[model samples]
Target: MKSIKSAGVIGAGVIGSGWIARLILNGIDVCVFDPSKDAPKSVEKVINNAERAYKNLLRSPLPKKGVLSFLDTVSEVAKSSEIIIEAVPERLSAKQSVYKEIELNASNELIITSSTSGILPSDLQSEMKNPERLTVAHPFNPVYLLPLVEVVGGSKTSQKVIDETCSIFSNIGMFPLYIKKEIPAFIADRLLESVWREALWLVNDDIATTEEIDDAIRYGFGLRWAQMGLFETYRLAGGEAGMRHFISQFGPCLEWPWTHLMDVPEFTEELVDKVSNQSDDQSGKHSIDELMQKRDDNLVDFLKVLKENRWGAGNTLKEFDDSLGNSRIDFSELDVSKPLKTFSTHIPKDWADYNGHMTEARYLDCFSEATTELMAIIGADEEYIANIGSYFTVETHIRHLDEVLIGEGIYSKTQVIYGENKKLHLFHWLHHNDGRLLATAEHMLIHVDLKTRGASMPGDSVIEKMERIYSAHKNLPKPEGLSRAVGDKV
Candidate 1:
């Protein structure tokens, strides 16, 4: 619930637009200033990409988006915003001038953050009148999905500014790694620079093509790096003895010239042509937008799998998801006497086929979520399940009546058929936003012991809640497709 009142973004290129999208999506109004004619288009594109990924990634309700306004000048943007983000070009003079303008129009209370990739925060803040409020909150490309942000404070910056920046970033679902000592290219980029330098050498020397180098990372160490990271990964690789033993085994290899560490390669036109052509050959078929879509889809699936296991980035997403759920409408507000409005969402692009129609499996996915929400209504939340037990779906019957397209808003209202003893039978009616019945799902679930994996008696408290709902629903007419088997007429 803690968030800033408003934010301002300067230079709506890739990074600036990304900040705008992330800020606005988290419900902070934004004033933007970008002199480029294409700034508006670029901002909307990033927002579109963010929205598409969010729909597939988070299961909870999203906060209402904040208002976005484009101001005529950088001074106007700074004057209107509580926080100012400078994401202009990397030139020192360009950044200093922007900071100077921001300081002139804004109060000393307004915090200023830079999205610089390699510039030191000290240099970034040196030109500002109130440099104490300056810090570097550098983020990776595709900022919405990737959670890591480097929060670096300059020598003149206040501890308050740094702390507040971290809090603001964390609220917007970012893991702000505080850099205690100001350094050029913070942390992640320093590591990335090493890899990039080596990759360039490999390409320049004809050791590997762009595709080959990409394949090695994507198919090999990249997978390990995503979950465990370097030192921890190597520690595991050390067999039973761990890090010390690993060093004993592989320390000698450091002396060998396996990489082109700091031996800088000449960036001749020939080298540039080679790298560019190779990259083109590798991914030339797909447009920039297509490449972005693929990257987002892959990341969403990875994060979803990690979430199920409660590991790595999954934990961060789970925390954000819980926060969203906490901010949502309470389940008790619903009338237990009627079919409950259990689940609702616009179908994400990832859920659709090439034709843009939602696939068959996603139908079951929607129903599963509806069933989960119903369980939550009847005292089967995570805490309850951990202490006691919960219901498990044993059977399902789904009738896909009408086709639904990607981006189409849909919802399900679930009715309790039988909510007593070990059995919990339910029926869900899925409807499009236009009032057409898109589908219906009938499910039967069993309450079970987590320890034994066998059927168990329902807890008295849960049974009491279920009994009340069942009593209220018992008088309703039976659903049309209830108990119907496949190939049987409804």
Candidate 2:
């Protein structure tokens, strides 16, 4: 399969713009064609939001964003693209015309995909000349953060096309699940539709308000679903007996009239008004933009937790980070005798406290990031942490020297004070952009075998590098706060 380096998007609606953001963030040049007068503005808004989310979502350094181009015609976009994704409105005739245009303008080798939520792939490919290149690559909203994408092939679609499409999506940090058979709505949407239908019925019957329904999911099973799907979650409910036991225990509920899955309530004006009014009441204080920002922030925190645990969506993020390759700065040319400038970043609004300045604990976070950078420079990167060994902070001493307000840029310079086979002593000085020292940290770390959870010496090469850095800093004048105890001299 050819590597995908450039892509074309046929629409600049929500899904299309999201695809554009994901592709560009993954370093794929994109050309977009959408005739809507407001396409440029809307797509630009989505891109901005996506960039903000990415800063918090990704821990590893990101590649330079690919160039984005707006084109006047579908033929123009298709000519320059290796993959053409159609995210036009969900109409059979409209989508068929898009496929026809793409087929005429693009090469036979070009991969063509549709982001239709439920339309069958075979129906979509019916009007195309080379239908074998067409398939459904359905993705969820906020595509840049969510990893799931259902790749379903039509009857005429080739296995090679499916495999290559999966590879391309995976390259862009997505988890592509191949559907063995083409079905309307594929997998995720079908499940979502079922819940949505039930939710509507509950509201229609006045059994639950819209906010209550949302609370039911967001406060309960929704958390479990992030890491474990329905069946797996139920398996645990069986209390050690597992899936079969759980089914036997709750099997009778299937026959019970507990759910109205087969029937759906009509979308009457009264029901719509009731649901809308309740929804407005529940979230009237926040605009759509605010809600979107909040959602993205929560997702970032959730995914970070998952990444640390190496489970679910976090695993996908970890794999993506590994694929991004090393982006650490080359410290070889620096004068090791002085403090090595390792990390710098702007303080985000979320890091501020009630006083509108950076919170106390966030200082530690800044220092920790600097320590990670220092480790990466000394060869304790992702591979070393996974396979060989890693340094764990055993003790930390933080002294706050000055206050840093929100939006201020801060940097840290680290020096290796001591190093041995299994022990490392380090200090970091945090400073504001104005050259004022904000804080300082002293940390003691121990190298440990990840598998054994015991202290272990790192490889000889890493040790040698640490020794050199230690030697460089041995004679440098120590900072005033070094080795000071928290007590007044009598």
Expressed as tens digits, the lDDT of each residue in 282-329 for candidate 2 is 999999999988998888788878998999888988888766645455
The per-prediction CA RMSD against the true structure, in angstroms, equals 3.8, 4.7
Best by TM-score: 1
TM-score of 2: 0.79
Worst 10 residues of 1 by lDDT: 325-334
How well is each residue in 1-490 modelled by candidate 1, as lDDT tens digits? 3479799999999889889988888888999998888889889999999988888888775778999999999899989998898999999899999888888889889989999998988988777778899999999888888888899999999999999999888888888899999888988998999999999999999899999999999999999999988999999989899999999999999999898887879999999999999999999999999999899989988988888899888888898887876553455675887788888888877789988999999999999989888888878888889988989889888999999997788889999999889999999999997889999999999999998999998888789888888988888999888889899965
